[model samples]
Target: MENNTFPLYFNLTMFLNLGSFRYPTFVLCFLLYVFIVSANAVIIMVITREKNLHEPMYLFIVCLCLNSIYGSTGFFTRFLRDLLSDSHLISRWACFTQVYVIYTYASYELTILGIMAYDRYVAVCQPLHYHSRISLRVVYRLVALAVIYPAFSVFTCVYLSARLPLCGNEIPKVFCANWPIVKLSCVPTGLNNLVGMLVSTTTVFLPLLFVLYTYLRIVLVCRKKSSEYKSRVIQSCLPHIVTFVNYSITVFCDVSLSRINVEELNPFLGVILSLEFVVIPPILNPLVYGLKLPKIRKVVFKMLSCLKRCH
Candidate 1:
């Protein structure tokens, strides 16, 4: 296709065959979206409202839950709409907008996780200096870094993909993504690929490595401590570890699906993998934190009891 003849809308080809299953799938997805939003929102609300819970750790959890809501809203709102509609077409501007929201959401996830790891590290390895090190001013700076860095990096990526002269517009998956759009380019995408690799390394792998390193130090610190002390440390760290590992696996599934030949795979499996990163983490983060952390759990239970009494 000529540069000037670029299509105004892209067909999200993945949704074309839902047929009779569409309504059921739409209902399931709609419910899932609602739960994700409500769960994350409760986490945010609980953390923010309770003064005792307003530590560096809980504040980070609030950031995480807020990001979950932002990311899920970006995807699930449009997704639920798409599920019920006969047409799967998305305008070029809207497609790029989704690309920005989703990509930034992902980037924010890793960055926030990285900061959370740092927070845990200070709290565990240097307890005496935890407050001094992770002071209110420092927390603000870390949060700012987490938010700003991702926005800038993902924006560059989306800009690169958006500027490409596309030869096609049938995005194979359920949602708009940078790689699929880049793949549609009629011309060479060496620069885009190069920058993407650099961004991925900085935003994804570097944070992952940092988390690993922080945990390693925490482990070494635990070696000299009493059983009770070790158990306490484990209790605090377990939720972050679980959240990190779960998110990493989901991200891997989505990234691998994007790069691989999906034609050989089952269509249902393809959709599942595509939706994994967006769906699983948002729901899981709240559950893991709410159930695992004693303080948060107590607050949550207390809130439930009050609600019951009110009812």
Candidate 2:
């Protein structure tokens, strides 16, 4: 009860009753966190160092990788800390911070994917205007919008949730998420739920809709083009589509798991669902790009050859 003196901290009840399994879970998650960080970091480093990769597509890929790192850090570090500690409580401020970072990262990923879709649309549809339209300056603004728009919306939701009086302190999930936090409110959460829905639609799905539209047009154009043109589109656009599909499915699972009763679900299933977003996308994006994008793949191969020669 002494801990009650700090009303701002909330108990994370997801790991309760794990007993001996927590140790192995901790080790598995720690290694995964390391892999996610290192993999994303390598992609970012490769993008930055390769002068030829300064174009819009590669730059957008850089933003995606950066978002993965940002989002993963927000979750994994706290998860690791809680794994080692007997207590799994987070200060309200830290919870809100995680909510902001993780949600913003998700929104940013969608926005960047949309931008990349548009970039490809222009590149394939209006090849002559591609250089003029998606210039370096334009890429800068797209990246800024991806970051700023999500931050503003998420900040609004978090700010609203923070002002609410909480009736509960035990969050059922492993890490802090906005929906779980909203469910803890003592007062009427109609306003919070409304704002949450509004922000979720505006920041996440609207961009997704835009991506769908752009890709539709892209598909139409590809239908009329030569085999070589189609090949080019497949080469360039497939990675984005793969990344988007993988992220969408994992996010759906995460949201579904959070809304349902954790008591009914198996603990292992719950853990996997909770970690789907943090684990899958961060590790998957780099692999998709590294293997799919020719320029990046070429650079990776050249580096591997150089290392081989050195040995």
Candidate 3:
């Protein structure tokens, strides 16, 4: 961290270690996190309350909303603590908590995306087989995978990767992330680094690759399909394309962290990098799909009217 601030809610027994100018930026980021939370919350409600949206696609979307809400909130909570504090010192436990949360939710989000991509693949590539292959039981199981796999994956990574003891905590990144946490520990974190990075690749790339391949195949089919289904397929696939692009960039940023020194990273670049992962995709995916698909928009309007009347 460029400047110093106390980890919010510090009990005054720990050393604080940030530089001077980081707090204000953290504050601004905090505000943006608040907006993200609010926006995603409304997205979840809209998807859930609107009866017409109770389909597999929208169900996956609602799952995305929940994942984004979880991931972003975990990150911003730590950011909030730092933003409110005047020093950069964070306790070992606090740092671990942040890392665990952010990693778990991120892993969860990636898993969800993979499941969604599979859903789309079935819908588009195997239309006749889609209903049989992707029954309610299967969607429910996919949802379960999205929810449960993160716990298993994150726990495995946290357990297997972080065995070293922390000597002095000068955590490199402003926020606590797995690689950064490994770097902070004085004990040789080389193995941890390698394993952690690999885990990250698995968390990120597996779903990402599936999504890419799924979409690519979908695009091919779209070209061959009747013009009637083309528009809807194109509209649906665009959102996933946008979402995948965002994920690719974010995974790039994270993987790059292992190779670069955080101190040398540019400040403005840092803010944008952090924001890009959650803020960009959730906002863009909904906008791209909801706006392009007239049916979702129409349903949204009807739902809004119903809400208005209820109020």
- Choose the strongest candidate by lDDT: 1
Per-residue lDDT of candidate 2, residues 254-297 (tens digit) = 87987899879988789778888878999999999999998999
Candidate 1 per-residue C-alpha lDDT over 1-311 given as tens digits, one digit per residue, 9 for 90 to 100: 45343678888877647789989988888889899999998988999999999999999999999999999999988898998888989998899899999988898899999999999999999989988999999999999998998899889998888888988878989999999889988889999999999999998999999999999999999999999999999999999999999999999999999998877788889988999999899999999999999999999999999999999
Q: Candidate 3 local accuracy as lDDT?
A: 0.68
Candidate 3 regions exceeding 4 Å error are 1-31, 190-194, 303-311
**Which candidate, 1 or 2, would have the higher lDDT against the true structure?**
1
Better of 1 and 3 by TM-score: 1
Reference-based lDDT, each prediction: 0.91, 0.85, 0.68
Please report the TM-score between candidate 2 and the true structure: 0.94
TM-scores vs. true structure, each candidate: 0.97, 0.94, 0.82
**Residue 57 alpha-carbon offset, candidate 1, angstroms:** 0.3
In model 2, the worst 10-residue window by lDDT is: 1-10
Candidate 1: Cα lDDT at 125: 92
